[model samples]
Target: MSALIYCPFPDREAARAAANTLLDRKLIACANLLGEVESIYSWNGERGDSFEIGALFKTSAALLDDAIQCLAEMHPYDTPAIMGWRCVSVSEATAAWLGELDRGG
Candidate 1:
């Protein structure tokens, strides 16, 4: 199975650093960095808005747990946004690549 993980970073540098770390460690296949996303949400019982960099990572479902943990450890947010969604469908090549990664082959 494949999964897409979403993680938000405080800034572009932070996002780049995290992406480099994960990529170096082979925890994720690729990370797509979307710069300066406007995030509006409620926190501490109050509405807040901020500009954050968003990174979408593609990896295997089996690696989701480790990937989330890695992001949590490396992220600057007191409560970082690291969420996972199932990649129930994907292109054939992408699916095959995820499978290979999961098997570490």
Candidate 2:
């Protein structure tokens, strides 16, 4: 199954750099860098906020865990938010395209 992964970065350059790394490693097939994200949260017993950039990654379930690990390692923030969910359905063409890279075979 295919998956869509979400991760936020400090800037577009950071997002693009990470995306390129993941693509080179075959951990993700594609990434969509969504602009300026306003985030609010509580951490270390304090309310926190951030103006970040977000990216959506496309990969397969088989590679999701690996992708998360890689993203964490390269993420600028200590506590990066990396999330993903399996795609229940996709267009035939999308499936076909994603399938080509999903298996890493």
Error of 1 at 25 (Å): 1.7
* Tens-digit per-residue lDDT, 1-105, candidate 1: 799998888898998888888777777888999777999999889999988898898888888888888988988887998999888889999989878767775
TM-score of each: 0.90, 0.93
Indicate which candidate wins on lDDT. 2
Candidate 1's displacement at residue 13, Å, is 0.9
**Model 2 quality (TM-score):** 0.93
- Where model 2 places Cα greater than 4 Å from the true spot, the runs are none
Instruction: Note the residue pairs that clash in candidate 2.
Output: none
- Whole-model lDDT values for every prediction: 0.86, 0.90
